[model samples]
Target: MITPAGTTAVGVDVGTTGVKAVLLDEAGRVVADAAEEYPARYVEPDGAEQDPEDWWAATARCVNAVLARARVRPADVCGVGISSQAPSVVVVDRAGSPVRPALLWLDRRGRRACEDRADVTGRVLATTGNRLDAYFAAPKLAWLLAAEPAVGQTGAGVLMANGYVVSRLTGVRSCDTGHAGLTLLADLDTGAWSEQLVDLWGIPRGWLPQVEQPTTVVGRVTAEAARATGLLSGTPVVAGLVDGAAASLEAGLVQHGDVCEMTGQSTVVNAAFEASRLRRDELGTMSVLPYPVPGHHLVYGSMVSTGGILRWFRDEFGDRERQLAGLDGDVFAALDELAGTAPLGSRGLVLLPYFLGERSPVWDPAARGALVGLSMASRRADVVRAILEGTAYGLAHNLEELGRLGLAPRVLRSVGGGARGRTWNQIKADVTGLPVETPEDARGAPVGAALVAAAGVGLIDDLAATVRTRQGVVRRVLPDADRHAAYQRYYSVYRELYPALRRTYDALATLRAELAP
Candidate 1:
């Protein structure tokens, strides 16, 4: 049912490849939606960047599109919540205009700086639940400081996508705990930027944006921004989360022992807890975020690759199927048919699924993927099935390690592109020996952003209640006893393959670089 006017909220997700906006009423149903794609520039061989202007342009397009589609007046949007890809480093000048291209999260060009400053990073992650790798923002920021002397003169401070847009909207520069965690500047326990880290990285503390809770009202939209994006000038903009945390909220995994696993080009498993502090051990990773309420914390354990591996197969081996799927038919149906032809365990073939270096539990980037037990008799179907099972095994391994730390959960909620495929969902259930549930919308980040905005505007008391209203959207996939048993044998082998192939991966890395020229 269409909602009565003037009680709706809008969620904006500024992701890596595109920007997505969703409009929802007080009842949590989506009333309008729009998406706008942008480009990520590979400025160097291993570097990725995007113009901060592109993000704002995309945001304007999405906001305008959503309001036009919903036929709602500017006054109807009670509040707007923003979520964006984490770890993006944007340097803005005193005038709040970007001084350089934004350094994206996927850019690996800063690896040397990240490694050379490992000690600084280690101390930071000890409090933030992330390490000094190319994934976080500080190293990328440091790289910019060294590479662009112009940055030192023109740059005023480092702000992420959320803060960048917030500045554009309100003329007040700020970010929430979620994006702060990605910066490796915030102490996870205190949820404040650390002076010790600032000294360690030798960056000016004055440049950092003030941190706020996710649902706290940052500021009202500026008249100029309102004119540019069609939002009411006085509309309230709330502090929002990183995309993964927003997805967890949309999946309703906001309580202790609740887990949300997102499978996109990457897979990230986030677990929430009410603890004031988490142990600083290295078994897995943790990040502090607003606990669906004030004074709460959430931690995340992530894997670098999940569906990305499967996507490689679909593109390489499913050319004919893709052409057929172009006609609006199910492309995955063809893939599923191929997987079905192969037996459980892929006839002893196993895949490691570490195309990108792994995160959490293992915490080793030197780790690489492998396919074992290949033979002349092995067919394409067998290889395809092995990759699918390999990804499931990776998740199972991550969950198992999470269990060792006393972080096990009863239910696993799935959301993201990979969760929609029945065969993939079934493989996850069978491999993990756990029931998997998916939300009706399955568009987790945007939904979560809307809920956060509603909570901020007093439409919902808390995140848990907001999530409860949408529980009916979830459908559970139960474990299959026989399939679980077969996967058990395969998983044992899968776990062993990584350690066994570590030496091979190191040599292969060397070989790959040597052959590059």
Candidate 2:
């Protein structure tokens, strides 16, 4: 129900691979939605970059499309919300023009900065409640400052992906707590930037953007932006959230121990908790961030390259499925259906879904993807099934880490594009031995953003109250005891595979470096 009735909100997500826009009405139903895919530039094997301008262009196109399809005038839309991939380093000059391509969340160029701070890992852990990883913004910001130098242009700005787009749309530069915590800049305890951490990185303190609460309406759409995108010139726009937090909110993770896993480019299993009740290192394998919801914190066990692995497989090996797929066909579902005939346990096959190395629990950038137990009799279906089961193992690996911390979830809510895969969802359930609930519409973050927008502009009273009353629209997948029990053997092997091949991964890394021209 709309608090005032008859109002709508628009939400946009600036994702790593695409831009998605959704128009939602009062009943929490999507009136219209559209998406546009954009590619990331991989100039170096370990480096990833993207033109921030491309994100804005795509976003404007999507917003216009969404508005046109919904047939809603700009004046009637209540507010606008945006969420984006977290902790990316997007440097802009005084004018907010792109100084260089944004260093994406996937970029590993800052790993050296992490290694450079090896002596202070404990301090960083204490300060940010998170280990130093290249995935965070501050380290990459340091790399950009040093490597590009222009990023340090006295009045230049450093922001995340969402902040950059938001600035383009509303001319406000701000970040929320979720992305702030990962920056290795925000003191998780104080919920603000720490001077010590800034000194630790030798970063100029002035470059960081202001941090605000997720639902704070930071600005209104400017006339310039309204012309570029089909938004009202004065529509309210909130500070927005990191995609994971928004996805978690949309998945019904309202209470403590409400576990949810977002299966997108990566699979991050999140569990909420009270920050005061937990010690700094209690979540060592995961990072703790201040939740968008008040008085709560989120622990994230991020598994790198989960869904990306499936996309890679689809592009490289699923030619038949793609060819047979009709208009707007979902290649993932088609591929999963092909695997239906494959035996459970994939007939003694194992796949390590670490094609782009790994994160969380392992923290091994040199880790390699591997397929074992293949034979002449092995078919494409077996390999596809192995891929699904392998990603499930990764998810289970994360759940195991959470379990050790006394935050084991009773059930897992799957959210994001990858959560729509029935075979994959079931496989994850069986492997993790947890009941999984997949939403009828797995695209989550955008909706959460819209909900936050509704709350920010006073269209809804009490955000938590509205979510607590969210309609129960989900497809529950229960784990079969037999399947869960039988998957234990392969799960054990998956756990051991990485350690056994560590030396090989190291050797391969050395050889690749040596062979580089």
Candidate 3:
């Protein structure tokens, strides 16, 4: 193995549900890792918030654990890199104290505002290749400014999770292009904050963090941050990409002709091109990021829920799995086995996996999950299989929408826990009619963050070169033509269910609200 010179760095991922610090060598080998979970508080159905303090505390705990487990001198770790859920709207006072809970990416409280402000959708997208969806920070910031009077009146707005972390570490607020692009704030052409959008959203541009390149060294660890986390003062911190973008780089999909499907709490598809391939509406949005090389851009579309649908099932139906597990089989394995036995299309059972509304294609939060075609003969296996296949069909739907933009990916690089399930991987391949590839190192986002740190400190020349040299391809799952044919029929039905039942879903939401505690 060709080892990198003076190899050790920590990549911290501030995710939706947790914060993890992965320690790696410059060659991208994992040394030690630590993670801490924090709550994503949902005060109401559409609301999501987290304390910036929780993130800093979790980050500190995870980093210290990594260092202790690795038993290496702090000096040996040359640099640090960060990756996080993007486009959060956080407010902090002058002393770097959070004025209010950070409104997270999962937050949908701003959807109404986004829908009402037509100018944000078109004007922002024209410059940034994005939409005025609640997923971005602009509308969330507006919601925050209106909801929290004190924070709005006196504090500055930080663009994302990493920006809050940066301010804590350096006592200066900052964000990078990948994160800024998600905020509906950055001008895709100029790579600067959009003044017109800022004015329209009623956000003061000064409240926005200073923008930097993904690899730009922001600042050293301040003494306060150093004490909280066992790190050497003056350590270089790289401006990191958003979690999905970093994961794409780790999966070796940075060059044109490569596509990455990051399946986590949500599913995101990012494709690299020589230049921007701008498209609007039905196809989704475009955004710019610093490529492993200069002057390259990444285009992507995102869905609000994917594996999350499975997680919902696992948590809700865990008792079913547990009952089976008592018989000496692993729960997920048993569920996989049962789902495998069910027919490709789940015996006429079709599911729309939009438990938390929808993202991508429809971009409607009011959308709800539906299980159509139930019968007296239906079994648990059929229900489980329908859920799995339904999520795959949703992915296929996203692909079809991307087709409107004229992007036909030859193959998709799959990352995260979803890729580990053999049956799930095959379902995606067959449903999407595209081969799915996995990386040898499966924990992608963290690995990508570490590689960026290595590149940041000169251990590697750039991210793409680092990924190609270090990351290995595991295997490819080819689409089953026969399975594809069957799914095509079922998918046609699945597509219609959402439109046919949208009004019913809306009514159900109102009823649930009326019955809530």
Q: List TM-scores for all candidates, in order.
A: 0.88, 0.96, 0.91
Q: Rank the candidates by TM-score, best first.
A: 2, 3, 1
For lDDT, the strongest prediction is 2
Q: Which ten residues in a row have the lowest lDDT in candidate 1?
A: 282-291
RMSD of each: 3.5, 2.0, 3.4
lDDT tens digits by residue: candidate 2, 1-517: 2232239988888988788889988767789999988888865457788999999999999999999999998887888889998767687777888888898888887888988889999999988898888878888877776787656864377888888888998898888777888899888977798989888786787777788887888888899999999888978888888888888878877777889999877888988777667788777688788887777898889888888888888878878998889668888889879777899988889999887778887988778799999999899999999988998999898988888888878789989888888888889889999999977766778888888888887787777667666637889999999999989888999999998999999999788667866
Instruction: Give the per-residue lDDT digits (tens) of candidate 1, residues 330-424.
Output: 66667766777888888889988887667665655556677889999898889888878888888887787667667877779998667777777
Relative to the true structure, candidate 1 reaches a TM of 0.88
Q: Can you tell me which runs of candidate 1 are displaced by over 4 Å? A: 1-5, 36-46, 118-122, 282-290, 311-318, 327-342, 373-384, 508-517
Cα error of candidate 2 at position 276, Å: 2.1
Error of 1 at 102 (Å): 2.5
lDDT of each: 0.77, 0.84, 0.76
Better of 1 and 2 by lDDT: 2
| Tens digits of per-residue lDDT for model 3, 228-261 | 8888887777787788877887778756757778
For all candidates, what are the clash counts?
A: 0, 0, 0
